[model samples]
Target chain A: MKNRKIRGAYTQYKDNQVTPEDSYWNRRDFIKNLGLSGLAAGSMSSSALMATIDRPVNSGFNTAEPLSTENVVTHYNNFYEFSTSKRKPAEMAVNFKPGNDWKVEISGEIEKPGNYTLEDILSWTRVEERIYRLRCVEAWSMVVPWQGFQLSQLINLVKPTSKAKFVAFETLESRSVFPGQKRGVLGFHVLPWPYREGLRMDEAMNPLAFLATGVYGKPLPGQNGAPLRLVVPWKYGFKSIKSIVKIRFVEQQPYNTWRKSGPREYGFYANVNPKVDHPRWSQATERRITDDSFFGTKRIDTKMFNGYGEQVASLYSGMDLARDF
Target chain B: MSYLVYAAIFRLLGADPQEEMLHQLGLWTLILLLSGLSLTPLNRIFSIPKLIQYRRMLGLYAFFYLVLHILVFFWFYLDANLAELFDEVIKRPYVTLGMLATLLMLPLVLTSTRAMQRKLGKRWKKLHQLVYLIAILGCIHFIWQSKSDLNEPLIYFIWLVSLFSIRAYFARKKAQ
Candidate 1:
């Protein structure tokens, strides 16, 4: 009788309210309150609940930070290509389908430089869940659980030539599909077309460099950079260029979009350095966008290398971050 | 506006509603200040003198939003840390400019009442000429603070410049 009662002691409480909290409360709550049709998984096992249907073998990286809610993650994105406004993208891109036959071109100093289909590319790399702290230069952050593989795996498969000094990634340029690109305010392009980003050869080869194809164990929505996007955990979120169409292994430091637009404020080495403040705002602290009332969430001090310094600080060596930043 | 506050409370303002609301409030303050400044020109341009009657009200409302904007900053961003807020205003150039512009508004708002306006007479116009400086400061404050998008600030600057030119032309004509 007690077992059937769900909450043995708290009889009035609902099963969800009484469910004994494991350390996986965020994931459990996430799955339980997805606010999507996936809720039909109520009958499924909690282990399988993570992926909904297919329980693939995913030995993924883990993080202790509570993941941001699906509602917040999906709805709120800085996808300026779709819309300059954060809230507008989800609605603006509701009909946007990246399509199955999307091809990614690998050019420049790569040995096997060719156009690979999305399915073909998927076959080459292993996809796994990686809960990463996505810090924005705007002094805000979100902990997102992404399903992706190490970018190094793709780099290895492509086999960059000795001359290759940098890797440049470009966003899909479809002005027709993306309104922001088509007509910025009063016909001014808000930013340069074919939005781009780059990383040094070492940065590209780092174990933390990822190519996310999914978020929250589901295929990414168009607003959140569908198809595939870079996920450089230690750098600012802008470094993670989205909806990539091209990957170029170049001999020179590639021209990144933000740096091209605002060089004084944004730089190529946009490593999440607390000491290096953006010209307009301080990076000393970041508001972690989690479950809170409008003004309730307290801003936490921005960490050196975004708390992933142990893994990546050696990559910077003795370089002056302030100068590069 | 209260709509921004309401939208933020209901989560209608999207993720990071506080940030969005802060921007919205600041933007509204600028718009109101600009609108208030344009009334005389608007009256002259259209030959409708009645438009000048609402300038004081617009200025007061602009002051209201500016107050709300600062309160939100203290409440949400600084967590009411006066020391931190002080550090920001002192250290950060854009923040410093904004703080200065807000502080200058104190005298304007205080001497805005009808009895005070009548008491000062011609001195009222001279004291209120401080608005031109205030407008310039406000424009630069917004312009310098804009991280990447210069278009918005540039437009504000153009508007401020045009307003200054019109006000100067009127002043020169009156002096003649």
Candidate 2:
């Protein structure tokens, strides 16, 4: 019984509680007093259980800097399926239902290709918190703490064949949910749906590549790509496709939505390179969106590979970044 | 007049006020300038000579909003950095086109006074004709600056083309 109790404590620790001794003891006392009925009530629903989960485990990937406030992180988004405006997604997505029965279809050049529900996917991998700097192609950026597992973990389960050279992702297509998909004479035909993005096989397996399902210690808001989304930190934010439903491992480089929409402006690789400027705007500096003062946002010189050069620079050793960009 | 109310509504909503303000100002500038250009054609078509009286005020208001647009851009985007603004004007093609359009309006604005218009005589008509070119440049500036969503700019472009076609038809008739 004593050994079982010790193992239970270890399992609890691994579940994301990384508090120091004092807080841990205090929490233990609180749980002890709450008794069996309170614990049962908390675990009755997945969301309620998630609520008890601590706000982002210190996965050691977080930057030394403080995370952006959850309010700003949740409110500001670039989910163009709802609307092109940054604020529109937050507003319109309130009506969007990501539904509890979400499933991801994984196929192409994989041994274990099948449709896996969100619960099955979650059960297969270990989720952890990773704070990454998200840099948009439009010269704006934010630091967000994402809760998810590494893309490689999911990739490993599928067991890619030698023929699988690229990994393509596709977002959900529902005109009923995504009002932006509707055709109108006055509406802008900027992007073709459903949104698509791809990564070279090696890039997909990179340590930094993540499949996020939650943020701020809760299930992701619909606007922020609930259920599943790709998070490729080294690339421009557009490359990180959101609300993904399909993952395909293919032989050739797949067509990315942004690249298809604006070939001259958005390149296929979409790496965060400062040297290459968009036709309409310069990319040398980025406005840190979190730093909003009365004067304006703080502009900082954009870092090559978005300050992840140490980990990602070697990936493009032989290629010219400017040309690829 | 309604533009002010629209701006007030935007401000109250607590949206990205800077971006909305700049967009609205630039849009009104184009609208007013185009409206000013339409005045002579309207006067000719409807035989209402007094309609031309509002032309100068409309043109001046267009220039007013343009100046505000530039000021907002400078204040928000560049943090009023004159050096960086100069660099943008030099390096960016869209900025160059926009600035050129604004600069071309300067001479017209100066000569818009009754005293100067009377002093220049026939040259005044020829000089004020720059408004047509300015309108074209403004459309190009807007279209060029658009990243993707060219619907609005395309509408403006079609408007300018139709307006020019009407003026051209009248010009040919006058020559005949």
Candidate 3:
């Protein structure tokens, strides 16, 4: 078995004609060989970068199960920006245009504050691929291969001031595009518009805190927060705000959208803790949504810190998760 | 009739057919229960005795759908795992209320026959009044299960309240 696996890898490497210098020329040549135009090639290569990165199972994470199919992951989403239904986000998000020339504004308590374009941000750090379990607050989960750099890298570049103790994130809000934001019969008022989320300074700087730009080896679909988004594996999926437009370094904890809309049900911290039940549902178990079958989706015990306890459990050692949650 | 059509459509094209079917079945059960309760007031307002003939059919339909809803939850959601079903009923308050509502319907359904009704005489009227309690429990179960967006449950609550208020007003007048 081992010899066969090694042989397979060797064959793959030989087929790709990989060499030390191949990394530089392979991208351009590969895209040009596909007959794509210059503009199309640039976007395709950036998204394709995710597939090129090594995904050896790192210690303290689960990679036993196969990564969920891109179809299931993309079609099933809780992006309330587009619609409330799990299926509607992918459908209605067709109208939403995540412009290629996106600019993220960094301000508040940071030494170097300015509007940085997506390209400028990409140039600041090297992107790597990480397989993480994304557990939704709604008692469902998906294992996704995310492509991005550690958020700490970006935070370091901006040089947060000593007084900055928290990091607040804000997503793009366009009423004309985001159907949920419109104030009419078609709109949903379950959550405050322009979703906001925050994390403690230590948590924000944690190696696990990632800013994902792509998924499944492609640029994020409009439904799944194109361009850039946060991915804190241990926290509930809502904490990973999508289509982030602003990153504020602040002294106080920011008001998160879910917390603001329903304080009793949603909390700012929003960690994935089975012991802490939501007001209406149990958090002990989750339905691992894959493709639907006759037997239905599988239900599994939810792990504390979403199975990243060894890495992140100490960050909240003294605080009460139940209270914070 | 519409409920069956909706269920068929959901089965054909829904992303999560089991979930959609469970929701639709539970909703129809509640709607039919409320409809059964409405027959009396509707008959009185119209001064027509013909509507009373449909009451038993509506109540039976409600019970039928309620049973199907529970079965769907057991077979699809729990995969027919009796141990987990028992655990869910004990652990979750919403599940408990739902089970209680189903259990309460059993006695009413058993005594629904003409022979059983005749044998009990006046006592049957009091026994059948359990439907009101069942309706309340059903609404509570629906409301408790909702995580957010209480609009649908809230509408059910308002409908139940309106039906009870009308019954209460008639009972007071009858007393005088």
Best by DockQ: 1
TM-score of every candidate: 0.86, 0.82, 0.79
Model 2 DockQ class: acceptable
lDDT of 2 by residue, A91-180 (tens): 898866564357899999999999986766776787787778889898877778787889999999999999999999999998888887
| Cα lDDT for residue A14, candidate 3 | 26
Would you list the rank order by lDDT, best first?
1, 2, 3
List the per-model TM-score of the A chain.
0.82, 0.81, 0.81
CA lDDT scores, all candidates in order: 0.80, 0.78, 0.78
User: Which tens-of-lDDT digit does each residue in A1-325 have in candidate 1?
Assistant: 1222222211222233222224346555665565355654556644455654223213224455566667778888888888777889999988876654678999999889999866667666766667788899989898887876799999999989999999999999987778778654545677898899999999999888999877766667888898789999899999999999999999999999999998988999899999887776789999998743585355889998888887888999899898987
Q: Indicate the docking level reached by candidate 1.
A: medium
Off by over 4 Å in 2: A1-60, A184-188, A291-296, B1-16, B45-50, B172-176
